[model samples]
Target: MLQVRVSTFSAKQLVFSNIDNEFIQLAHPRLWMQRICKRVGLPILSPHALRHTFATLLFSKDVNIKFVSILLGHSSAAFTIDVYADVY
Candidate 1:
């Protein structure tokens, strides 16, 4: 619940990156995720996989394809349906 609030009010641009407070490199989150996966005993998942999962869940809920397409930054709804036709 608190996580939701922080994300809602705080910077929506970068959740992990603190440009003003800390200097981060590309390898930071990579190593962090590796440690987390090791501790949780789950397969490592990439950002792309998470994004796909989010879209799949929204489609499964019968959300508008055009809305999903917009959220995904796609050029058009037809392309979204073309890529995710199986879900529809």
Candidate 2:
């Protein structure tokens, strides 16, 4: 949440505004992911995987699925459950 706030609001005044995207660009995230994967020698992953991790962690904590779904901006809790039945 803080990250989102910083990216959306505080980022506007930050000096590192040279990048094309305001907050985060797909290229940077992709390159960063690639660099990490190379350093760790793990399978490739996209930034979206972080969202899945968040949902799984929330579900493991027994947070309400509906709330989690909403937090994820998912269309519906049922959709979230379908994707994370293991966590459920």
Best by TM-score: 1
TM-score of 2: 0.63
The residue-level lDDT of candidate 2 at 7 comes to 48
Give, for candidate 1, the lowest lDDT window spanning 10 residues: 1-10
lDDT of 1 by residue, 1-88 (tens): 3233234355454646654434568777777877888899989866567778999999989899999999998999999989888877
Clashing residue pairs in candidate 1 (N, C-alpha, C atoms within 3 angstroms): none
lDDT of candidate model 1 versus the reference: 0.77
Q: What's the TM-score of every candidate structure? A: 0.67, 0.63
Which lDDT value does model 1 have at 19? 47
Off by over 4 Å in 1: 1-12, 19-31
Q: Residue 76 lDDT in model 1?
A: 98
Q: lDDT of each prediction vs. the true structure? A: 0.77, 0.75
